[model samples]
Target: MKKVLVVILVAFIILQFFPIDKTNPAPTPGMDFLTIKKTPPETAEMIRTSCYDCHSNETAYPWYSNFAPASWFLKNHINEGRKHLNFSTFATYEPKRQLHKLEECIEMVGKKEMPLESYFVGHQDAKLTDEQRKLLIDYFKREKAETERKMSF
Candidate 1:
């Protein structure tokens, strides 16, 4: 049992040397949300602080992301989030997809389902106050409506 325990500890230590990649994917020109839309600075900052880590190509990886298991988790989350909505590739999506993503964004923020709770453990600043939530929720609704209107034409 003692030998087994030591071996497991050593294996875990060794795994740390094989840390997961935390590098942000290179941004593509003409496709990114910022490039396609004129975002308000305050809203952009809020989105950057709250959602970009997992959702965009601008993830600000922290020190813990250098560790093996944690890095693995972070990488998985980033991948999954991008699949759902990659702001970095927003305009590259079909127009209907773009509108659907905007609608989903509104639903997620309105229900407090985004910026997942696990994310908040390491990112207290991502916490949205009631006022902030309202602001974002309203913004998301308006964006969704505008996108829908544009798509209709």
Candidate 2:
């Protein structure tokens, strides 16, 4: 039993050597939501503080992400967040897709479902207040309207 325990510990140590990819890609010019939309400074700041880490190409990886299993989990979250809605690549999407994304953004904000709890754990700044939630929902709703208008033309 002691020998089996030793092997398990060794295996766990070996796993630590294999690190996960935690790369943050560079932002594309004029393709990001902030660049394409005339977002208010306050709104933009809030979004950056709360949502950018997972949803944009400008992730500021925390020191804890350097470890093995934690880094793997974080990378998975980043990939999933980007897959759902990448603000950095928002403008590159089709007009219809942009509109749909904006709608989803508004819905998610209104539901207080964004900036997932795990993300908010280490990032207290990412936790939205009632007003911040309203702010995001309102902004996304307005953007959705603008997208619809543009698509109609």
Candidate 3:
């Protein structure tokens, strides 16, 4: 038992040196969704708190993000989240894809599937009130309508 414990401790210590890269690339103005859409201040704040960490290029990493196993997990989740929907690169997506993603965003928020429960566990502020959810859903609907209107013309 003593030898096993020693090995585990050594492994934990060694793993700390194998840190995952958490540095975010510089944000480009053209890449921002807000630049193209009318994002209300309150709604923007909610998104910043709840979604930006994973969904945007400007991820404000927590201190624990520098720690070993947690760092690896955070890096992986962030990468996956960005792959699915990167608000930072919203303009880069094709119009059809953007429309689809916006719809999905509304559905996820409406169903309370966003900000992932695990994320809210550490970030209480990320939890959305019913009103916030409605606001987000409305925002997505408006954006979708505008996009469709523009495409029709």
Candidate 4:
């Protein structure tokens, strides 16, 4: 037991040397989601607090993210999240994909599947109230309508 504990402690210490880079480049105003779509202030704030870490280029990494295995997990999760939805590059998505993504966003939030369960544990602030969830659902509804309207032209 003592030898096992000692080995674990040593491994933990050694793993700390390999840290993942979670740093994001400075945000440009033109590259923001609000710049492309009309995001109400409150809704925008909610998205920033709850969704941006994984869904955008900006990820506010926590202290534990510096630990080796944890850092790797964080990096992979962020990468996968970005692949699914990158709001930082929202304007670049083709219209069809954009529309589909918006629909998925609404569905995810309505089901409370977003800000994934693992994320909310560490980030209490990311937890949304019922009102916030409604606001997000309404916002997406409006956006989807607007997108469809434009496509009909």
Among all candidates shown, the one with the greatest lDDT: 3
Candidate 3: which stretches are off by over 4 Å?
none
Global Cα RMSD, each model? 1.6, 1.6, 1.0, 1.4
Candidate 2 C-alpha lDDT tens digits along 89-124: 988899989988888888887888887877877999
Q: How close is candidate 3 to the true structure, as a TM-score?
A: 0.96
Which residue pairs show backbone clashes in model 4?
none
Give candidate 3's root-mean-square deviation (CA, Å): 1.0
Say what the RMSD of model 2 is.
Answer: 1.6
TM-score ranking, best first: 3, 4, 2, 1
Q: The CA-based lDDT of model 4 is what?
A: 0.88
Candidate 3 per-residue lDDT, tens place, 1-153, comes to: 999999999999998999888789789878788776868888888888999999999998888887889999999999999999999999999888989999999899999999799997779999999998998899988999888888787
Cα displacement (Å) at residue 115, model 3: 0.9
* Residue lDDT tens for model 1, 4-78: 999999988998989787667897857778567667888888888898888888888888888878789888989
Candidate 1 structure, TM-score to reference = 0.91
lDDT value, residue 84 of candidate 3? 96
Task: Assess candidate 4 and give its TM-score to the true structure.
Answer: 0.93
lDDT of 3: 0.89
Deviation of model 3 at 148, angstroms: 1.0
TM-score of each: 0.91, 0.92, 0.96, 0.93
Regarding TM-score, does 1 or 4 come out ahead? 4
Choose 2 or 3, whichever is better by lDDT: 3
Please list all clashing residue pairs in model 1, or write none if there are none. Answer: none
Q: Quick one: best TM-score, which candidate?
A: 3
